[model samples]
Target: MKGDLSTLVFTGCETSGCEMSRSRQYDIKRFCFQTWYYDATEGRCSQFWFGGCGGNENKFATQEMCETICVEPPGRGRCYLPRVDGPLRCDQLQPRYYYDYTKKHCVAFWWRGCLGNANNFNSFEECSVFCKDVGPFDEPTTTTVPPPAPQNIQQFAPTPEAQQIDIVSAEQPQQQPQ
Candidate 1:
């Protein structure tokens, strides 16, 4: 599979694996890891949980890899286009970011999850990076918020101090009488 993938990548062939659905193989051990996959229909890379076995080549180690392999490089004019929320028929509402040519910065918006133009990006950083050179502004005017973490990935637990504060707050001393 590795050899075939290398060949396909080097030859610039359309890899059928990009069209495969995210596969979380069922295993007794159940070793799951966060991974990225190319969503051919949406024309973007998205995060998915991989069971660490029996998945297709669509699984990429990083979003950049998936985009490099599956997505076409954006054309010169793509950055100047207005934000598109995609068609109304698709109900999946995904939080996405796009470069606002007028605003001259990246802004977050809800994408309808299909057929949006290349202006749409998975994160503010991505949109900014791609459109920075193309836009009228020399640099983004607004402060950037870090992109949301992947849904399937586990977030860090609260700090020990925070937990202690919560415990103390929960155990308010009982007052005897007024």
Candidate 2:
């Protein structure tokens, strides 16, 4: 039996008269089939070829796809939100536009054929399409409020005729003939 252990080390298993150990007794269906097994060491699902003999208990037939059973992906466990490497460029052969607050309108500008910020748009149409709808510059409305009415306020209109009357009244000052 001691010699059998040595042979098992090289051959992985004894071809004859070797019952599966108690740990591997669960693999009752060890047959020639490609099955998926969770490779805990690599944290992924791996293809395992089951021999028509005794084997380990890690065999799984479609019960463990890599995504569902393996470890979490690069970031979150399930959902993957890609990183924003950089801002969207403007020199993409297609004309682009940007909204200028000073101008109060979408203005056309040529990108320097280099990397640019996301403040730019791919086209004038694209810029105008969303500039009005999604920002502080939507369609404008005008409403006029009349000025307040006069409140006991005296406003004098000194015309030339009023000045002449005042001069005559000054010259013919009140004279009592008594």
Q: TM-score, each model?
A: 0.38, 0.24
Model 1 C-alpha lDDT per residue in residues 74-100, reported as the tens digit of each score = 353455444556544555567888776
| Most accurate candidate by lDDT | 1
Candidate 2: regions farther than 4 A off:
1-94, 134-178
Clashes of each: 0, 0
Evaluated with TM-score, which candidate comes out highest? Answer: 1
Candidate 2: residue pairs that collide: none
In candidate 1, position 158 carries an lDDT of 53
lDDT agreement of model 1 with the native: 0.61
Question: In candidate 1, how many Å is residue 132 off?
Answer: 0.7
For every candidate in turn, the CA RMSD to the true structure comes to: 13.7, 34.3
Give Cα-based local distance difference scores for all models: 0.61, 0.37
Positional deviation of residue 142's Cα in model 2 after best superposition, in angstroms: 23
